[model samples]
Target: MNPVKTIQRLWLLFLLQIPFALMAQHPVRLAVAGITHGHSDWIYNRKLRGDIEIAGIYETNADRVQEFRKRYQLPENLFYTNLEQLLDKVKPEGVMAFGPVNEHIAVVRACAPRKINVMVEKPLATTYKDAQEIADLAKRYGIKVLTDFETSWYASNQYVRNSYKEGRLGQLRKVMINDGHEGPWAMNRHFVSWLTDPVKNGGGALMDFGCYGANLMTWLMEGQRPLSVTAVTHQNRPDRYPKVEDEATIILQYPEAQCVIQASWSWSFSRKDMEVYGTKGYAIAADPVKIRTRMQGASSEVSQTLEPRSAPFNDPFAVFANVIRGTLKLEPDDVYELPVNVTVVEILDAARTSAKSGKTIYLKPRPALVQAGNVGNN
Candidate 1:
């Protein structure tokens, strides 16, 4: 055979094998910590795509365990009643949490001791104290901890973040985010008991929807601590959400800029979007996949579409894989880090407190009642 023909045939064979090579590479070993939260579907869909292996799963509630198992048609053998047993047996490299937001600390505490990484659904924890404890554990164990925001994966959100970071919008002036939907009851979510429990879900819409604004604001401000936060939460349907607030508004006051976060479960329609106004222009994450921009003096808005992010930054599994392999370095000031999450949790906590006390809670010391304070006192 001619040498050129021989070389071409070999190259063709290699090309044919590349697809299998890529498919088998970078598969992350993962486990599930809770399935009660509706967000479990996000990770489950990733599992279907073979991005991560569901090494094991545990839930305190047997019914929940079985319900999820049957719902997803997961293998019965994968369920473990005890968390420790699952960890000891499967020994996954990471854990994805889908339980109540308040359970984050306890689950992280368990996984950290084994040097296993963890990814929790947004808001980090129900309180700042829990956030701190999880931070300490992650530090001691030398494991990565990430708080997964549905918005974090949004290309439009990143577009806004990069726009401000690059000073494309000039000096930052204000951030206005409106995120939420019609009531969960209206949608008939199956596992909403915890989502409506003030202790478990952590302040209803202010927590469920408000955290998106807090997380994005923290990232945009470059982790600058706010002077104070003022907020108000209301329960429009007291009979339905007697224990929690269904609608809430939080304001974060910085040195030169302010952010208004409106989160609610009571709305005319569903919405999860944001608007960022700077000194010279403004950008809006009109939706998850679209961005609309307007210059200061422009007569019309310029709309652009954003392509979804690629692997490592695209999904939890890919990101977790890069994290365990030491390829992705999440800075302490990064929005996903514990310190940032702590502040986010603190802001939410203060929002609830402000609603109860009807005062602007200053972060410097305590909520010293002031006659003229006006941030969250409204």
Candidate 2:
């Protein structure tokens, strides 16, 4: 072959390889630790979709492992009796920690030393100190840690967020969120083991549901941590949840705005609604998938329904994969940012304190200098 023709053929082959190289760059391998949360369904769905390969599962109890395998149709080979064995063998790209709140710290501690990224289920930790320790370890090792606040990543919520950013709501004034379900009785039996235990679950209805409201409030308000929190929780169903409170209301005060969040485990109504009020207009997310807005003097209300794209786990998992692949950059203030999860823990802690004392509890201010660049590296 002529030298010029051969050189041209080699160049053409190199150009063709670019797309395949990008595709092979980062393939996410996920191992799930402690599948006790009911939301494990999302993770199971992701595994089925081929978005993430299920490297293994770590569960302490044999019976629970059997139940998980049977319920989710997970292969027997994927179950690891011990977490350490699972971590060492799987060497997964990341771990999904959906264990009980009391067990959260220990799981994170175990994974942190291995420099493994973790996506933990929220109420980040059982206590403020434990949460801080996890945060400190994450920082020390430079690992990406995320809490599973799936609603914050919902496209409908994104629409509302965009409206807020565009000043469609004008100056923010107040935000109200109501996320109440039937009760723990309606929840899966697995949740009963830990969720009703204040020692295990951290707090009652407020900690379980109010965290969503608090997270959304902070997320939409541009990462303004709550200045103070006041809350009241009642044991409406002492017969069912004898040890835990079944109803709760929390008020969070911010410097520029205030938010009222109500959650009830014993409520008759099934509602997940949020209304954000601003100087010029108001926006409401009637459900997790719809955003509706009304501006002053507007002839018609603006409405948007999010088209189904990826499931909750798939969306975050894809983002996490990109981060690991160095294609997506994670900002400090982003809700998925690890430090923000730490802040969420602090706010929930303050809320618990307020609920117990029956008084507004003040929170320590976040450091001024640590801005958007200081979060987990993507």
Candidate 3:
């Protein structure tokens, strides 16, 4: 046996095994802060799959707490009635929020001082003000704050990005995004009330689904601010959702391109899909599972049933687990990052204002509060 060659080979093997070793050694300890929103399924279901172990869960709604307890078969003690109590007892490594869009800040505030990382369902919060607080706390505590989106896990979206970068998708022109469903009520009536309330959930479909289009367009534009935003919103089902608009159409104008964000709660069925049109080609992300691409003057087209990119990008559970072990770092500009979500909220705010004013509104990127480490130009 050659000692020198054997030593080099052994070192290579060890280097290759490092990541797997770290992954197997310990799983991330997580706790859920709220289970009221229907989106909580994103977190709790993962626990059911044994994908992630939630050390604790919390909710003040007795009915919801009992319902989730019955569904998950969680022990009485595994569910806490208070946020601080859950954190104090379990001392989990991180917390994943599944509460109302409005409570994102309170959840982060509770977890920040403890140095626990947090990931909330998309939009970051109900307003830009809350997002600002989230960023400040993240900077002060030096903990990761993530906003997860089901779009971030789609291969079709990634394929479009890859094509554009490779010069195959051609010069970007317009992005059309339609995201929503028949309504939150079609999913769960109890959750629908807060979801439809302007105060608790912001502004119906515009608030709930508008963030998706904004986040996608922001990422597609490489964080460019829109010249102006024009929007119209209305309640197609005012009898059912009198407090908020159930549908909205927002147009965002960029220097070289434009985007149409169609967010609605009045669709015949559930939807969260997009289409990208460029001078030389076009791509359609039909739901998350399918993608079709056509190139100008090409002999044929390409289609894909895209698989998830990898861990972290694959799902929220995978991402947070790696984050806890210090393996994955969230980019400041990443869709899940604070700055990106702030822009999302900002756009939603403008959309709402535009809807109410019945006019176009200009948008400027607000200088990030914690801009010290912003990635693109910092």
Top candidate by TM-score: 2
> Poorest 10 consecutive residues of model 1 by lDDT?
369-378
Better of 1 and 3 by lDDT: 3
Best-to-worst order by TM-score is 2, 3, 1
The TM-score between candidate 2 and the true structure equals: 0.90
lDDT by residue (295-318, candidate 2, tens digit) is 988988888887644543337777
For candidate 2, give the lDDT. 0.78
Error of 3 at 129 (Å): 1.3
Off-target runs (Cα >4 Å) in candidate 1 are: 1-26, 186-190, 296-299, 365-378
Candidate 3: C-alpha RMSD after superposition: 3.9
Residues 1-378 of candidate 1: C-alpha lDDT, one tens digit per residue: 899999999999999999977865756788889887887877666635655777888877777777777878988898887888899999998898888998899888889889888889988999877876776677667777788887877889889888887877888889999998888874425458788888888878999999999998988887676888899888899988888889999999998999999999989888878899999889999887899998767899999998887766777667766767666766656666666676788888888888889999888643312111110101
- Candidate 1 TM-score, true structure as reference: 0.87
RMSD of each: 7.3, 2.8, 3.9
Query: Global lDDT for candidate 1?
Result: 0.80
**Which residue pairs in candidate 1 collide?**
230-376
Q: TM-score, each model?
A: 0.87, 0.90, 0.89
Q: Could you tell me the C-alpha RMSD of candidate 2 in Å?
A: 2.8
